[model samples]
Target: MPLTGLLFAGLAHADIAPTESDWGGTGLLQTPSAQMAQEGELGIEVTHVSPYTRYNFTLQPLPWLEGIFRYTDIDNRAYGPAVLSGDQTYKDKSIDIKVRVWRESHYLPDVAIGIRDVGGTGLFSSEYVVGSKRFGPIEASLGMAWGYMGSRGDIDNPLSIFSSRFNTRPLCGDAVGGQFCSDDYFRGPAALFGGFSYQTPWDPLTLKIEYEGNNYQHEPLGEKLKQDTPVNVGAVFRLNRNVDFSVGFERGNTAMLGITLHTNIAQATPPPKLLDPPPPPRPTTPPQQPPEQVNWADVSRELQNNAGLKVSKIARSGSELIVTGEQTKYLYIAQGIGRAARVLDNHVGPGIDWYTVESTNESLPVVDTSINRHIFDDLLDHQIDLDDFQRSVEQDAPQPRQEEVLYQATPKAFDGGLSLTYAQSMGGPNAFILYQIAANYDAEYHFAPDLWWSGTVSANLVNNYDKFTYTAPSDLPRVRTDIRQYLTSSDITMPNFQLTTAHQLADGLYGMAYAGMLESMFGGVGGETLYRPFGERWALGADINWVKQRGFDQGFTFRDYHIVTGQATLYVDTGVQDVTVAVSAGRYLAGDWGGTIDISREFRNGVRMGAYATLTNVDGRQYGEGSFDKGIYISIPFDLMLPESTVERAGFLWEPLVRDGGARLQKRYSLYTLTDDLDSDNFDDNLQKITY
Candidate 1:
């Protein structure tokens, strides 16, 4: 499984929910409905799951009752011409919604009643469970569920075997020659299963064991094969406030391997003191007299009266104009191209200027040699199919997921290189422009095909470093060898420069592009090597992007390597809060190629704070060796308090997928807090009102 899902495993209260719902989340733990209410009485739980990855978010909505939502899906799929021919494949999604009826505390047994697979293709089944009892160091629980089930045991296609080359027709083999195959692969009705779990009373460790199976409603389909008698066993260990681990295994017609994880949500593992809500908005007084009328012509003419300032109107629509102005302290606008927002804080200057420049005309660099020049004017857009990618990985085998890192910084040659250019109007429409010097170095590291996260991708321009590290049983592969060999032998270099442009094409629609090139490196068991062309190392593909805003502040982009990524958001005005929802699909065109989707929303009150859920789909290797690993993850930023001195945070990033996969998440989660450049000694003086 992808290591991302391991990010959420245990519960702070026990509502059986992960806490948040994110687009690219993965499920590494089970938060069953009945179990959620037992953990807490007044909490809410949100369960987010994908084809191969499942995520559960349970909370106490009340003190005595708990609400729960569980989402999980597995699209039965098969690849390779041979396997694909012998079986029928279809996408499947399972959703379970319920309200726990009770929890056995000191004297009584726990109970609950609710719907299972509620908003899904009903297997025509629901479950009722109860539990409470301790046998010395062992704790146990029992539960039963009844529902509609499907079984297709008698259907047999000839592709089942060790090699794809084998072709044995019924007439050519004993089993086939007998023509005994029956069309019974899909058949089943109501069934039963007893669920139970146990743990040591003295330690944080836990153990679980359970079996679920059923008898057919008609008769034996094929040769009276065993039913759904699946069994599972797992345990967890809380290493510290910042670290924890878990492992579990299940077997039957299908099997699963999993782990648990918990990390910082806020600066403290135990939440910080919630501050009292701010005072309500005060009533505004009506102006005693009408505002003084000022001559628009006089204001426009004043540009020339200012020190070395020049102003000219290039275009005009109605009340707005394409005005150009320049002075000793600032540069002029591009006619009607961009706009100017005011920030006249005395600490910085008289005011700040914002606008946009023509990127194609500004001489942008190429990063990936594989890509021709970025089609600057190419309007064709693409999107990542996260849902499809997740389904594909679940049916296939495991492959290496590509990871990269890079850095960049530009001098203050152009008003801190900030501009606000509006390409068009929507006020009619508010225009937007691309600003800020875009630069960064990219490093791509490969990991061993297992459940742990480890690798290194460093970008020199932005001073950003991404590291993925973890360990698993021998059954899983380790990435240490691959990373070492690549670093030692690869011809890839750092500081691959790139320039990005954020453009507003229309209302609720914006586009951005990043183009650059760098040296390409290849890695293997012994080491890595750079593929060269003529005597020069070949450059990687050009990194170009175009985004289409889906709403007031959300959009999706396509990188063109068979992947689609997008962002979603929810906004609230009480605190002027903003939440971001993001998703990524498809692999980097290498390794066990697949896609990942993540959904996260950010909340802010001047600073930044929020929780998110992420789901990732990779190939699985156990059932289908070489299968893509599937993963789910949930993470929250503990540090929203900005540093006092920092004019702008350079390399600091919280949007993990927006950063470089899991690298930024790991680093930000480690830091206690970031400080600013504002000196406390002068803080008091700056706060006093200024008089002319």
Candidate 2:
């Protein structure tokens, strides 16, 4: 999936100022530069230059890395025959990346290396190494390139000096397209490109000029144009910190216009929660009053209202008050526990020395969090700080609390959400994009904490998927390619219907089972289990499901196709660069034996971007277009966009070509997500928020 392009990041470490280029990266009008946006910086850009209209979504997931996904519409070219392509213009999809090699300094310029077209049709394939130096308000960049970027043949092959293999540049972009084209990298006549941008006296305007690398003779799909000049000029107007508009003239013939919407995700935060109840302020000094009379019923109400916990019971174990409940609102377990501690402090006896929260989900034990009352009080009284308090906090596996019962809670048996979802498939033979919009109704009934029934009913609002007429030929089972049929099946569809049960099998061990309609296309039974030591960086999980294909109409019916599928997965959270990796191997939906590796970066603010690829036993040709299953995905916290805080996220996954060979089930739930407290990051991150 890294080859596909991820779409999230935070800040940049480059000293060179970033400018959105025609090709989507940080650069001048027609060529890239050594500049890089901040990590977690994300941008959506649209550029038009003569015969090309390009839409680019670029991301800086790390300070030193940038990735782009671009779609280009070429003029005067049809995708194919009118009947098959519906008069659609030629559309090209490509991925690109840039990485910071060195940060600029007073004595030296910033440097970078990059690829223009990675694993798509090699229409704009090129590689370069560039450097940018700043002088007062002027910034200049110079770079050498190969492939399309070096079409001018301004110089002989520089890399050929090292090996004769680099003397010849091979033609790329296979008939099927989407090839890696690695052998063509930096092998050919090279070109020199340089540019300079000047910040004008006018605050909002900047001017730039760059030398052309390509002569316009070697073009995509054999299209050709005459180069009137080697120099291009552009001017950019910044409307605000997040928006920019630019216009330019390149090749002395073509006019260029573009707009970019950019923002940093890691630094972004939700607006103030003016609508919710505010937490009680910490006291400037510890209370010296006598033990106060307490009402257990009122304590339960306070915990539910202020802590977002659906309390099961509250008990006392000597000097400790233990509360067993499920967090129903807060995104982090520490948030819920911290809030509960505040309510307990006011309601319990003054002698209580410890506050413990035994968190649960669907009645299954999660983890235990205990905070020393003296340390908490000391912090509240300004006698200690967060650092001193953390030493007294303990998080571990659920523990037995044979204590005195005080308060009990009634069950709020059902909860769900109503959401609108927009689904899309892009770059099809018949159409550039096919999209569907639907309204979903989710419902769940709790039989008890350990068992429940949950399902989703989605009603189609509208769709433009009628043009989904082409299906790539696959030698394996058609487990996933039939998405078109499923999408068009009915006005109302029940994609999921299941009864599930889960319980804690042991310390660091959990188990779950479910049966019924498991997903839109499959139904039957499945089970999963996970072993995650509290506070550890690694976890092991496995899931197995036996399912039958569903009918196209999505009715209460099934097709004859059936198979057993499963996977054994290991997840590791590498503290370096806030990255996490997941490795899974087992049976795939198409009866293929394969494995998948997923890599992602997560920020403390709840924004995550990742890519994954799966390889199966089948040969590349047998697996159909694009070879195998691979995609990029991003998950953003809904709190960032909503008026009020919510423990929900918006997610999007981009799959270039969805095939069957390495397909995996889109599970309704996972232990990794259900019990996210298996790791200590959240606890450490949210510790200071307790008093707030």
Candidate 3:
């Protein structure tokens, strides 16, 4: 599943029904209402009513914001030329958004304004302001709409009183589509739509009645649709928490059947760990035994197997024991911290006053935390509260230690893993979904703690390349558009093989450099540096790379396309809701000068939802269908579903189209992501784990 839901999962749903309309919105049979599902809800609905069948994917990214992506098929129309689309049905892609205006109270109704079919081919475009109210087990909705949903022209548009520009509805979208036409919204004519839904005596059944405004004579494609009566009726049956089934009679003449699947992401919880060992029981008595001779090897093994820490070094200064290691598992760094403290309490001698754990990744230290051993012992003996222990802890950037070294890790030269990978291509001319299944094998050879050599091999196990016939035309250098060729070039390919190294340049500064095949389509050398103040909510980073396009076969061969691309980015945690904004001005892969803005927020469940758009010097017409480059990405922590805890994440990126205008090279790693926990906000969010 795409992990793009966030924040408001458990809000009350008593005011209105959490139902989908025939058009796949939260409402009645044919029109939308002001009611909305709980935030963080991701839903999919497929509804069919005569000449149309619609597939809708909706996400409530915010409590008041709902975004929908729809794929509508016209059963009566042909897709395109036979060679390009075969016998596929006509398909239309559209985007819709609704923003809440007011919440329902004792007297006021819930209200919202919305636009459908935004920036797409002119079909099914409409705008409306809807309000819904609930009384007992029944909910009622009323709204005024313009454009296709209001083609009946029941009255003059309300906006016409302000200006004559709101009196005419000119054509929207370009010949090839994908353009937003603000002038077309709330223009032309207007009509009223209203509906009511009643919850039945039975728990799972709800009945609906809607009065639609569209007469069905002025369809966008000029096809004539029939309307027996404006009144439509429907019933929804809730099958489970995440699924709904419905049947409806729409236009008073057509039959509609639909199904919806909904899931709340912000409320996601990982399943119980059935395979891992439990934490050792807390000691009942305080430490009274005198200090004993310690076997650091046994302690290191215990730390690795029981605490999920790959212990590399153990040192002692006075009464403190400093353990340095990588976290091999546990997405919640707090879990590791608590386990490490517990493990050390049992393994170390009573002389130790503080237990410190310095967490690193590939040998580069990111966070150093210290816990008062006495406070932990007191808490174990019921003498101190967890809050007291929390107050006694300290965290900072990795510190320079003058402790006597007790043990150092032996070099483990190499490590690797293999897994099955799946990839997809959507909205193609010939096929809606094209995919490939492959075996992914990757390995890392450690040359030193701060340096390593890594590479990955991908071999196709199965694919449907013969159906992949669409190739977008680009006037600029094809940095990313030529993906189809690369996917089918050979059964086996090497996408990346880079040598990377990093080191701390100063107190809050870090730097990393890399060379070799940077990605599947590009090979280059680049370096990135970041300055992240340990207790600040902001950071600055910059990167520069000189890259050349790789051959289709993805071997040790390069094409004659090369460019110098670089960027200086500013990252800020807005603090309003954990939203991070990154603004970057850079030279793109096609030599276009532009800036990209990325906004993202992490939910309570460790899912990151974000969207980004890039604007370059290229004009919309020359840049083609999607205009500028834009995409949405989702990163889901593996621990959410895995039996054992791990910090790894599965990621998904989606774009409406692949164009060459504002493309950037995909880096294997970034300093910002590598040193994320070093930032004050992230570290603090998980800091209380020290007392767990």
Candidate 4:
């Protein structure tokens, strides 16, 4: 769909200039001034968009262009998922490059174009564009792009939901043949969309209208498909500088009202003169005798007379009071002020450097008092929700709020998962959907022997149907869905019906094992029991399993398999000042599955390296020359260096890129790799990889 205004709202903010921003992980040269790079101010803006917080980073790259990077995390919204019965999450990390093609200074409206990257399935790298321009009183914008819409689906077949014509069978053949037949397209097929909008300048109002359409020419479903369209119209107003209101309607289905603010960092500073030079070494006057009853009035008046003191009337019901303000000239002044207020300065003024020990200790007593009065209430009120503050640290680092101390915890673990899945037609020519979700979670668990465990769950489901589609010819009554436009009448076929399920399980030596319905399907059971033996880094594990395949499935043969797997793991810990690393390795053996080796290493900075490879051959399979899919996938997530202001002292800009969990400064990065192992007939089988 059109991505207008989605990048930058039409506000009287400084124009975003394009400057080279350092995206830590990737290598790129920094662009300097004079190259039309970003200039002026740099900052982050965050707004609570209901369930999802809108984190927007704005940069004035130039007078005509604005760089806006915004992402929405729906994880904070609902508690669970739809369609799938587990937790579901949707995250949009969009990078919009906006350029102002035309601008008439402060009076003229500016026009800009933006390109956004939308993640999608193979064959189509979803992308869109928006163009906005101003013409005197009527400021309007138009947007258009060619790409599919919606989040990437975790479907067995990528094409099952999107354009099917873009779907091609997975490459199947001998190594050489597979190389030549493999599908080259990984992004989804392209779709087209367009939209436009209009708005006004002062009443500070904005109104816009737009439309979008997608063309499915080569329809991925192997058919000719019609296009789809959606429209939207909306307006936004500035209630004042800090507050804004917006309302919009989309395709007659979605309506929205949004209120937002741009909070300016408040800065309280001492006058430049007092801060630069000492107060003429406070005239060497004879030490005044300490007052007896404290003539508070005359003392207050004299204190007000002190050049460094500021006096203000503090009306009180019982007394006409005066407040004496002492500005701490520096870190040193804080100490002197504290000492002076308690002694020589008390009589001259109701001297109270509340900001020192008193102010800080004041809040402590409030907490202490509440805790003394009602410990449980205090505990509940001050309950440490680490997750809440961790999320807060991620959003606004420099200006972290009260609970930001949670960021000081060390990142103790790194976990990741890789899955290999294959599905095809089986018994009676019916298609089957079979896949396994294998994941690993390993982190330092103990002191001497680091405990770690890895497991995989294999599942296969087969459905027999008369036809894949019902819209086939009358003769093909077996087909359940429409496939008319998907293929030539002669090329269509019927669906076959079959039922199947695969069983998978896992358990610890003392932990409980509950197989439930899984034990009934596979006619066999499989799981592991593990224990930490001598050291925290060492674990002895064993797996017992029985597997049997029977019945008449064409490409499949009935077979029975059994095996006891034994595995021993070792972990070594290395500490370097603040950086720590733990390396672990384990080996397991089974019948046809042979012997598998797993090695993982975690760096203190959040980098993780893991590799799994199988070596032994069984079940009439060749020893070291079988065909198995082995590949390495690496993921490096370094700290996203976002400049922020400290929340406690919001005015001071601090380097919050590298966080120490509230301790010493720390930086984080990660790396991952997956490789294929030889001698495996399953090209997609990751266990056959040599290195990962």
In every candidate, how many clashes are there? 117, 9, 0, 91
**Candidate 2 lDDT score at position 261:** 74
Give residue 55's error in model 3 in angstroms: 1.9
3 or 4: which has the higher lDDT? 3
Q: Against the hidden true structure, what lDDT does model 1 obtain?
A: 0.25
Ranking the candidates on lDDT from highest down gives: 3, 2, 4, 1
lDDT digits (tens) for residues 1-692 of candidate 4: 00111113223434322212111000011001111222322334443323334444443423444444444434443322343212334333333344656654556434444333211112222333333333544533343333333212222334436656444334222321101122423333333333333335455675655543333343222333333325546565656444445565543554545444332111111112322222222224523432234454454344333322222211111111222233221122222222223233333223221211111110010000001112221222456442332222110001111221111112234334443332222111111111122222222222111122222233232222333322312221111112222122322111111211111112212121212112211223344444422113233444343333222221123334322322333323222221122222222222233344444333222222333333333211122111221211111121101121111110111111111011110001000100000101111121111111
Which of 1 and 4 is ahead in TM-score? Answer: 1
Error of 3 at 692 (Å): 6.6
Comparing 3 with 4 on TM-score, the higher-scoring candidate is: 3
TM-score of each: 0.30, 0.93, 0.93, 0.28
What's model 2's TM-score? 0.93
Regions of model 2 farther than 4 Å from truth: 1-17, 281-294
Candidate 4 global TM-score: 0.28
Clashes of 2: 9
Model 2: ten consecutive residues of lowest lDDT: 1-10
Per-residue alpha-carbon lDDT of candidate 3 for residues 193-269, written as tens digits (9 for 90 to 100): 99899999997999999898899999867898888999999999987666789999988788999998777765577
The whole-model lDDT of each prediction reads 0.25, 0.82, 0.83, 0.27
